[model samples]
Target: MENRIQLSFTVDKSLLLREAISQYGISKKALTSIKFEGGQIIVNGEEKTVRHILEKGDIVTIVFPKEKKSEGLIAEEMCFPILFEDEHLLVISKKSGMSTIPSREHPNGTLANGIAGYLEKNSSVSTVHIVTRLDKDTSGIVCIAKHRHAHHLMSEMQKAGSIFRTYEAIVHGSVEQDSFLIDAPIGRKDTSIIERRIDPEGKQAKTSVEVIKRFTVNGENLTHVRLKLFTGRTHQIRVHMMSVGHPLIGDDLYGGSLAIMPRQALHAKQLKLVHPFTKQALTIEDEYPMDIAAVLEKATIDK
Candidate 1:
C-alpha cells in the first residue's frame, strides 16, 4: 500500500535538493523517476525540481510508490552476550563475521536484529538505540543506548574525542618503529561507490600504533600492534596500516596475502566512555579473538 505524508511547515528556500530528499526519506533515484514520469510529485499544485526552495504556506505533496516486501527478508532472534546493561545504555561484544545491521543479503543474523529480538523478549528493557557501529568482520565491544536523549549524549561524547577506542591487530610486516602515528586524509575513491582511500584532499584521519610483539611466520615478519584512533573514518586502521607498508594479515582488500587468515586481523580490545545516566567514566576490555591468538601462537612457535 502506498502512503502519503503531508507537511505543514515551511521549508527554507535555500535548502539543497539532496537535503530535501534526505528529510523526506525518499531515494534520489525514486525522486528523479517520479519527475521523469510527470505529475507525480506536486509541490504547491505543480511539479518542481528536487532543488526547488519553499516559502511560507507552501504545500508539498509527495506520492510514495508501493514497495513489495522481499520474501527473503527473514527476521530471526539470536542471543547476544550482554557485557553491561543499565537504564540508559547496554554494551556487548560483537563477534567477527557478524554484521551490525540487517542488509539485503543478510536480512537476519545481524547484531541489530538480534538485539531487537532480545529487547522484545525482555520486557524490563525499553527503548533500544545504537550509538556507534562496528564493521562486520571486526570483532569488538559496541555500545547501545536505551533512549534517544542518551544516544545523543553518547554520540556527542564520541565526536568530541571524550570516548577512547583501542584495537589489536596482527600485520604482515614487523614495525621497525616502537611507536608511530599515521596522519592521512581519506575520501571516497569513487563517488559512485562506497570504497574509501587515502586522499590528500579528504577529511583528516589519524591513528597511533605501538608494536607489542614481533616474530616470524612462514619466513615473513609479523607484528602484533595496538592502535589508537584519534579520528574515526571508514577502514581507517586498515587503510592507514596499508599506507605504512604493513597491511593487516588476511586483509586481502588492503594488500594482505591469503596465506594468513581469511579476514582482517583486527580486534577492538578496549573502549572508554562516560556513562550517559551516571556521568561516570566506564572502561571495558575484551580478549583477542581466537584466530588472532592462533596467529600469535604460530609466530611464537616459529621464533
Candidate 2:
C-alpha cells in the first residue's frame, strides 16, 4: 500500500507562503507539479498561494499526488543482490557485466529491467530514479529512488558532496606512496569516443587513492587500493589509475593485463547518504564479488 502523505505545519511566525516553502526545503518544481496534478497547499483549511502571508498559529497543509510507475521499460525477472529497500528508495548490489540502464547495446537484462520487475511484483506506482550510476563492468551499491521527490532530494545531496561513495580495487603494481591524489583533468580521448585521458584543457577531475594492503600474484606485486572520487567523469577511476602506472587488474582497455581476471576488479564497496524524507543517515556496504575474489586468491605472495 502506498503511504499517505499529508505534511502539516503550524506557523510559528508571520511569513509569506513562498518564504515558508523555501525555508522548509520544498522544491519549487514540486510545487508547480502538484498544482498541475490538482494538489494544493492549504492554510487553515483554505487554499492559498505562495504570496499568501501567514500569521502565528496558522495551520498549513500540503498534499502530494499519486505515484506513477515508469512505462516502456523492459521488465525482466532477473535476480539482484538487494541490500536495503524502503518505500522511497532501494539499495542494490549490482553484479559485474550487468549494465545499470538500458541502451541500444543492452536493451534488456539490465539492472533497470530487474528493478522494473521487482516494482511490478510489489505493485508499486513509481518510476525508476537512479541517483547514482556505475560502469557496466563495475559492481557495487546502487541507489534507486522510488519517487521523484526522493530523487530530487538525493540529487541535491550529491551536488553538495553529502552523498559519499568509496570503491575498492586491485591495481597492477604496488603503489609507491601510502596515499595520493590524482588531480588531473579528464576529457574524451582524441582517438576514441568512449575512452578518456588526461588533458590540459579538460574537465577538472580529482580522485584520492589509499593503499590498504599489498599482495603479489606469482611474484608480481599488486596493490589493494581504496579510492574516493571527488568528481564523476567518464571512466574517471580507470583512467586516473592508468595514468598513475597502476591500471586495475583485469582492465585491459587502459593497458591492464588480463592474464587471470576477465573483467575489471573495481568494486563500489561503500555508500553513505542521508535519507531524503526521513532525514536519517544510511551507510550501505557490500563485500567483494566472487570474480574479483577469485583473482585476489591467485595472489601467491602477500606483503
Best by lDDT: 2
TM-scores of the models, in the order given: 0.73, 0.91
lDDT of 1 by residue, 1-303 (tens): 123212223456656544665564455565664556332555677866777766645666664433332234343577756778876678888899998877777677888777776665665223346776888889888888754445556766788998899999999887999999999999878753656789998999999999999899889999999999998898899989999899998888889876879988999889888775466888988877788888888888998
Show where candidate 2 strays beyond 4 Å: 1-12, 42-47, 55-61, 300-303
**By summed lDDT, which 10 consecutive residues of candidate 2 come out lowest?**
1-10
- Candidate 1 segments exceeding 4 Å error: 1-75, 124-127
Error of 1 at 285 (Å): 0.7
Q: Where does candidate 1 have its weakest 10-residue lDDT segment?
A: 1-10
What TM-score would candidate 1 get against the native? 0.73
RMSD of 1: 10.6
